[model samples]
Target: MRVKRYIVNALPEAVSMIRTDLGKDAVILETKEIKVGGFMGMFRKKRMEVIAAVESGASKQGGTELPQRKPSPEVNAVVEQILQTAQRSSAAAAVMEPPAQPDPPVSDKRMEREQFIINEIRDLREYMVKLSRQQSDLHALSEPMLALKERLQEQELDSEWIDKLIEALSESEKSADRVYDRVELWGEAKHMLEEWLQPYNNAEISRDARVVHFVGPTGVGKTTTIAKLAAEQTIKRGRNVGFITSDTYRIAAVDQLRTYANILNVPLEVVFSPMDLPKAYKGLSDRDLILMDTAGRNFRSELHVSEVISLLQSNEPNETVLVLSLTGKTADMAIIAERFSKYGIQKVLFTKLDETTVYGAIMNLILKYGLHPTYLASGQNVPDDIERFKAGKYVELLLGDAEHE
Candidate 1:
């Protein structure tokens, strides 16, 4: 390869010089306008600096031709910059002088060069943008932004969402041209999170559904969650509530719910399988609200999910709430959410919130699987420990500022 640099009054003169020196196979690799011949830095003449290259083995006599080598990334970047300068120069020239069409070969060659430059520019732009964004995320964050990021990461948030939140904060700070203090940062985080989750802020279970079923994996407190919700209906609302349990696999589960049923004075019915659903429904037919409990099993298996969905089947107006414990791993919780989502169980209830500090799984499940979070159970204290999933309150807990309340 042969490369030469030329300086002239403008790009057109430089192009003519390059063609005479480097032949038809020559390519303009770079172009820039620079100031030259300054007198005490007072005045200078603008000259177009052009860098052109040609294949060393190609025949100038149009006999033998060497293969054109692909440009390196550095070469591509240089060419892209050159193309921008060329476009600006051409635009200025178009306004200053009348246009003249080039010969067929010259026009075709120019088009090929432009098309090549555009393709290289697009690829280079995309790669550079992603690289810059990653670098910015890694290093450009201020102390306050980093603090908030660390806080959310500790709460087990997905990296994808964390970036979105941090980027929004970055934009806000950039616009205002000021760094926020801890209190201000907390306030911004709460506001943004609540806004993002506001669309899914259906905290209460549907009162319209006469029968509500609770399903979950073993030891996730499905029975206890049913008890808590039942207490709400019985004690708070004074509504006629009934309990039906198919948790015969665990005798303790049935007993736990039965104890709550006896205390609430709500009728209790136990069924071993889905076949007994009709008879149990008939027994609780007089009840205005029926809270049904399904046996918890390995949720990872599609077979178990199918079985649980079968038990949840009812012709009456009903809703199924999938209970999950906060102590569970985020990945495991996502898997359960995925499995249950396949069965069309959209509503969810989280249990044992007092046991874990990471509330990210709530946002993860809600946003990712479109799960409607109905309630959160923090303790064993019947209805007092359970509450509807308020977005504002959850954001407060998520941001770790019970003191701000």
Candidate 2:
């Protein structure tokens, strides 16, 4: 794909150009806002970079070209020839000794302006070259720059921010500064996650051995996580463990828990109503740890939240664990955690770490909730993917190994 970069003052106008010049067959790859010129012009004026691609040999499909399309092949050919002439002239000048320099102020200013315009033009020229060499489909470059443009208007619109935003959007495609390193920064992030997740550690699981409730949105691995914890306490620690599931709403949920209980040789109680809470506790009152699995609730739905709240508050679980998926968007996770905060969540369990490539949302959740996580459920492997949440480990994983060195 041929990737052509155009610096226009507007997006629609650039899009129009691509549609008209390159035809409707052109595909937008990336869009960004960059500053041109210096001081006032660079900060105050903004230009959009439209990175588009089109098949070089593609004809107007289904026949005839669009009406009134300007800058035909002849015009493009002439422009190309002129650019080629300019490049040859510039190269020849590079090898020759400089003439007596121009007057001080005029020379400096002219040089700056010339360099700026040349850099911009060079970037576009390189993009055009790439567009000519590659298959159109291989040159996808579209990026979300509207948000960056707004930020540029409000904050620093200098070349630095423009480049940083571009780098972030094209992270998978390009290698910029290894920002994820900075061990000190990773340490701070680790501390923040630990502080938020600190509550999930059930130090009193063997003491009071009271009902520990797990509540969260659907499919957060609460049942499987409970099993992992139970197995750890039973087989590893030799702590007497019992499981009680209030997730009688789904037959599979009960059977799943039952299967785990059967493997552990521990008693399992299914509580469908608030009255069944006492019975569930009585069935496993002698165990060292009572893991109560609650029904999954949709925090967005008032009815579902109310129902789950009623169940949890009826007996007031000694410890409430909020199970959240780290794969969810930061905004959505924050809102859900806040909504469920009313349930008196003492800790959090972040699941689906294997599904997410970035840890930004995890940072958001920890920063927002201030509930330390007890475990990170990475996969569906029972007792295998579940691991104790360690602040240092998380920091290391987030920043990666290269960051520390």
TM per candidate comes to 0.67, 0.51
Worst 10 residues of 1 by lDDT: 62-71
- Relative to the true structure, candidate 2 has a C-alpha RMSD (angstroms) of 17.3
Q: Rate the local accuracy (lDDT) of all candidates.
A: 0.79, 0.62
Best by lDDT: 1
Model 1 pairs in collision: none
Best by TM-score: 1
Can you write out model 1's per-residue Cα lDDT over 276-380, one digit (the tens) per residue? 999999999899999988888998898999888888878999888889999999999999999999878898999999998789999999999999898889988
Clash count, predicted structure 2: 18
